[model samples]
Every structure is written in C-alpha cells, then in structure tokens.
Target: MAPFEPAALPELLPLFYRRLFPHGPYGRWLGYGGVVKNYFQLREFSFTLRDDIYVRFQSFSSPQELERELQKLNPYKIDIGAVYSHRPQEKELVFDIDMTDYDDVRMCCSSADICSKCWTLMTIAVRIIDRALVEDLGVRHRLWVYSGRRGVHCWVCDDVVRKWSPALRAAAVEYLTLVKGGAETVKKVNLSEPIHPFIRRSVGVVEKYFEAYALVGQDILGSPESWEKVLALVPEEHREVLQDEFPKKRDSMQRWELLKGRMERTRRQGTAGKSAPCYADWEIMLQFCFPRLDINVSKGLGHLLKSPFSVHPKTGRISVPLDLQRLEQFDPFAVPTISSLCEELDAAGDDAEQEEGGELEPKRRARGRRAWRPTCGSLSSLWRRWNVHGEESCGGGVTCKETSEASLPPTALFLLRGHCWPQASWCLGTRRLQPNPSAPLNPFPPFGPFLHKKH
Candidate 1:
C-alpha cells in the first residue's frame, strides 16, 4: 500500500475533527470532573498551524466550543499542556519522556526516525518507568501516549501526582535515572550492587530483552571495534587480557559467551581481587541495555506533550495510545493516519462525499456521522467486552456515560492500549487493567507484577 500524503492534512483535518474526533471522551478526560474551576476550560492546548506557526494558551469553556474552534482552524498538530491554576501560561506538573534523548545508547535511527529495531528500547523504558510509577511513587493513573514520531509520553494524572510540586517531580526523575555520564564517558552504568530495588527490577527487565535487542539486533560484539568498546567497560588490565582472547571467538553470540566465561574464570581464580574492578558480563549488558531517559522532560513540571490522538503534521499519523498488554507487539506503522481514516470515510460512498452540500449544519453532521460509523464498526468487540450499553454519536454532545465512582475513566483503556477509539468508549465493569501475564518466551517468562488501577 502507498503511504500517507502530508499535503492533504489541511483539507482532511477539519472534517476529521468535526465528525471523527472523539471530543466527548477528550472533554471528559480533561475536565476530569471539573475538580477545579472549569477544569477543562483551565487546561491549556497548543495548535501547530501550517508553515509551523504555533499558537498556545488556548482553552475552551466546553467540548463543544473546543470542537467548533478545531473545525474552524484545522490545526496541523495539537499539544496538551498541564492544567493550570488560571491562564494556562502558568504550566503545572505533567511528567513525560522523549526517546530522542536515548540516541547515544541506540545504534539505530537518530532524532525522529524509528524502526522496530530501536523501538524495543522504548519497551524497556516503558517497563522501567511504569513499574516505578506504581511501585515506587504510588501513582495510579498513568497514561502513556505515542508521540506520533520517535517517542512516548507518560501522563501521571493521579490527583495525588498532579498536586506534587515541581521539586518532587524533579526528585522523581532523578530517582529513576541510572545510566549516567555523557557520550564522552565510557562506563555509564556503574553497578557496585546493593543496587536499589527499582534498578534491580529494571535490570531484570533488560535481561529479558538484551540478547534479542543487543546480541542479535544491535550486534554489540559483532566486530573488533564493537568488542573493544564493550571491553572498555571492563577494567584496563582485564580489557587487555580479553582483547587478546576474544578474537579467537567467532560472532557476537560466541564472543559474548567468551567474555562472560573469561570474567567468571578470572573471578573464580580470585583475580577479581587484583588492582582493578571487573564488571560481570551482566553489568556490561545492563549498561548497554538500560533505558536512556530524557531527564529534562521528566524533571520539568512545565513541559507540554502532544495530546494523545493528535495528528502529526509531517507524517499525517495519529499520535495514538500505547497498548501495554501487547506493548512488544505495538507497531508504529500500524497507526491509522488522519488521511487514511478520511479515506475510509470517503470509501463509505459519495453519498457522504456529497453530503457536504448547503444543508443545515445539523443535517450535514447527521449525514457525516452515519458515514463514519463503518470505520468504527471494528470497535464493537471492544465495546461489547467493556459492556458499553447505548450507541450514541455526538453531533454536539460532550460526554461519555457520565463517568461514576465505580466506572472506569471514559478514555482510560482506549488511551491505555492506544488504538481503540470512538473515542468515548469506556470499561463498564469494575475489573482493573492488568499487565501481560504471558512469559517473554526466553530464559524467563514475562515477569512484571500485574497492575490493576481503578478509575
């Protein structure tokens, strides 16, 4: 199939927002019960227009007002900033992560380009942060969204998390950070053990993926140059000995085996007590595999992240949610573009194409609304699973089942998994979302604790 055309976004976005946008769920998500004065109205939105013009501090009193403004401007991109005390210019706490900052560790694409090869790094990062957010800091409502490009954004919206001061956010980022030093530093991960439980869990997560990601995918020991770099992580004395012996080994896998065996034999011979410290092969691997987070992004309380479901102007793809259940299976290429969704709407037949005639706004909305239902027909099983009753489309209603204490957040799971969207869909039962219980299929099964957060 052919790829998306960025040039068509200006024409498609208006109609996309008018008919296909999940304004109801989005309104419900932001308004969040109007916890403060006009919560939805107090939240900030940034619009990226054609020619890269950026407009910020725009808020609406209600979802309807927001939808009208969106249809009017047809912004190329939408960024959601933190909810504020007053004018959104004063940003608040909203922790996020940018994948580009990890370029130093990844051998794959740099800046905005991403492929399945480096995407695994994101999985590791998510695993690390997701666990810590729950286990370490006690956050419950964490919403992770794909950046529509190379990274992911984590929104820790637990009311308790929201109230955290900027200092606490900075402290939290500092706590999660481990692989330190810059490009100039050779030994980034220093494991003197008695490691924190958080890092220990992170290391376990890396162990699960290292062979596939590093030994096979990255080929960190594939050549003499790469081997020498891995060797640099060892002490200078041990490095010389390993350099002499590793060449006799063949390929990355064999070389890695030899490196580890050499370290063990030496330590057993008590050579580890000699002048320099010897890092276990696992330590070297952990250094190579640990998540390289963007410290500033998480540390700063004022950072704005692209709203979940925002269309990337350049790629024309929707910045959807990440499916934590099938995270390893989440494919960036599978995300539906705004143009593609519009095309699906078009394929519903020209009766819809012609519905744009000078009919009253409500009449056209009705016609447009009916035309788009086929695109959403795939979501039936999901709705059925959630036990969503009533099928209503907003020509202009701003709601989703009037969320209750017992009900899941209207957009929670859909945003959690990243693809299911009407976007007003919600989980009706009291069951909480659990982490994937399946094993990783390697030496160890997928081993993280299952998470079940109630909304």
Candidate 2:
C-alpha cells in the first residue's frame, strides 16, 4: 500500500465521491425496507467540511438525493445518525473499539500507532465479540468495519436491535465487558472459580494468540520493568518468588510457564486464601487481551458513528467493511487509500493494449464501479444476510417461498425496494445532485445523554 498523503484529499475526494462510493447498497442497507413511514427520509446525516465546518441534521428524500449532495459537498467525513420524531426513534446497536484503550497492555506501539504484531488485538476482538453477538445474543446480521485509523466498529442490524433501549444496550455492553477500571487500577480483571461459559469461550479465543502475541510479540515479561506490571496481577506471596525467578528464565515463554506453574501449584495445594483468586492466570490473559469498548458509543441511540466507506480525513483511508470469513487474514495496512484507488482506476482506463470496442471496453466503463467492488461486495453480502425473507431481485419482482437470499445473485438483491435495475450491472450510474444544506443544529441536546466525541 502507498503512504497516504493528506494534502491530496481536496483533489482525490471529488473523484472518490464520484466514482468509488458504494451508494446503491449503502442506500439499501440504511433504508431497512422502509418498514416505518419515511424511515430513510427521517434519518440524519452529518458532514464535516475542510475547515471543520460541521453540518448536522441533513436529511434526504431518497438515496439518489443523498448521492447528489455527497458529490456536491465532498465532505471530509460522514457520520450516520438515527431517525427521529421528537427523539431518536431507532438506530442500529453499534460498538466502537479503539486500540489506544489497550495502551497499558500492548507493547509494540503506543497511542494511535499499530503494526502487524499489535493488530492481532483487533483480530481477537472481532472473533470474541462477533461470536458472542451471534451465538449468545442471537443476532443474525452484523456489519464490521475498519475505523480507517486505529480501531474497529460493529453495527448490529437485526430488526429487533434497532428498537433496543439504552438500558438494554448497557446490559449488552456490560455482558461483553470483562476488563474494567482505569489505568490506575493495578488488576483490571478479577476472575473466580466456575467461570461463565462466555468467559471460558472468550479465553479460548485469547489463548490461541496469547503465546505469540503476549509472550513473544509483546514480550510482557522480558524486562524487569515490564514484568513488574505482570507480577502485580499475580498473588502477593508469588510476586517476590516470580521476581527472583524471572531473570533466571531464558525467555518470556519460559518466564510465563514458571508463572503458570506457581498458579497451578497453588490451585492443586488448596492453600490459597479466599481473597486470592485461583483463576488468576486466566484473569491476566483477559486483562491483557480482551476487547475494550467505548461504552458511551454503544449505549446511546442518538450518538452518530462514522458512516461505512467514509474516508478518514487525516489518513485518507476508506472505512471499508470486514468479511468475517477472512477475519484472521484482514490487514489494516493493506486497505486501499483514496489516492491508490484513483490511480488504479486511472491506470486501467489508460491501458494501451486495449481496442476501442473490444471486450475491454465494457470493463473500462465498469472500472469506476469495480474500483470499489470489494466494498460493494461486502455491502451486498450484508444485504443478503439482512434480507432473509428471500424476496426476489430488483429485476425480478416475484417473491419465492423457502428460497434463501444467498441463493439469489447479490447484485439483484442489492436494491431491496424492487427498483428497476440492470441484472448484469453492479454500477449505480452517477447523477450530479445539488442539495441545500440544512441549518446546523446541536447534535447533543441538553436533555439526553449523547456521545460527544466523533466515533
């Protein structure tokens, strides 16, 4: 991947919004069947301009209208908000995970920086959280997206999830949250015997990567300074012994084994006090590896989240959706930047070997749409999962009983409202739309609790 140049955004964004934005399925995904009257029209969109000029409560009559305004404004960032009447009517239950929250445990990089070694934390997070959402909570459709910078976001789009109350959202977050307290707290995770099945499964996910991620990649016990933090999480009597034994061990793996031995010995002897946790090893693993969430982002219905496919202004990277099937292989650094994509499209169009009306001519015209084919494919796949009723494709208006949405072609199902569309094309042709910007309104009202920070 090429290094993202922030200075080129002004030149790159117009081309991006024009050719690369996945507008068709994006509209379908947000429309949600128009189950409620004027659902799409009532939803809010907020845009941030070049000079930090913020515009909110921007509503559109249709997806075409939204597309037109997007080209007109060329927003530096786009945030999706919930539909509203007097208050927030409905919104997808969302979750935000920032890598910075794990600064205390991660050793490879600090603050907003990330590398392949530390990126495993994100992989672990997606696996654990996604499993719980599907198996435990019974949610069928979940859309995961890279934050374009240092984190990941999940939008739970089950029809029932949209109407979840704040208290219910809090409960779900609480269920997923294991590592607690702030930086000052010495031991963030405290575990006891007979651990819940959820915690056990979560630990199973963490254990797969713990040996390589923590012991070798992070080297949590390699130095006295770092081992001191690990020792603090262990029992009081064992810390002094581990402190003496750590330097004697050959490597971090050996030191970790020694620590594990002490814990196992204590468990087998039954000599530990009631105050001491027998499952401290698991707790330590959870503390260092479990997903840390922004509870405020998940709990508030009115809170706005960065829209999927929104470009990170600073990095010039698009927030593309994640394929759970390829979760382990996902690489944040490999995601395409606006500059690289534009160059790819330009290069494809300028191919000298191609004849004017040959087979390559159609491909040249489709280049703009295919530039974002991976992203559009993700959105299409998400729609397949979302539209479980097996409704016919936009071209075919007939609904077939007992037919799975997956059985139909993805492009046909892309438009959920049965709008007439070409069966062979994934391209939703460009239209220049000019929308009047709504007057800016305060996103956070005095009465309700809303997430203040831009997620």
Write down the lDDT of every candidate, Cα atoms only: 0.63, 0.72
Q: Which residue runs does candidate 2 get wrong by more than 4 Å? A: 269-277, 357-455
What tens digits encode model 1's per-residue C-alpha lDDT throughout 42-115?
Answer: 77788999889999978787978987898899898888876676533333344455567667666767887788
Query: How high is each candidate's TM-score?
Result: 0.77, 0.79
Candidate 1's C-alpha runs over 4 A off are 86-95, 262-277, 350-455
Output the number of the lDDT-best candidate. 2
lDDT (Cα, 0-100) at 400 in candidate 1: 30
Candidate 2 total steric clashes: 0
Look at candidate 1 and tell me the lDDT of residue 205: 86
Clashing pairs in 2: none
Looking at model 1, the pairs that clash are 321-418, 439-446, 440-446
Q: Global CA lDDT of candidate 1, please?
A: 0.63
lDDT of candidate 2 over 1-455, digit per residue (tens):
45779888888888877766767656766777565678788899999998889999999999889989998999999999887876897888999999999999988899999999999999999889988998899876677778999999998877788899989999999999999999789899988776799999999999999999999999998999998988899877777888898999998899999888777766776645433446777889999999999899999988999998889998888786665655677778766788876775565344422323345555553443332233233333333333333223221334433323332222223222222111111121222111112412211111001111121
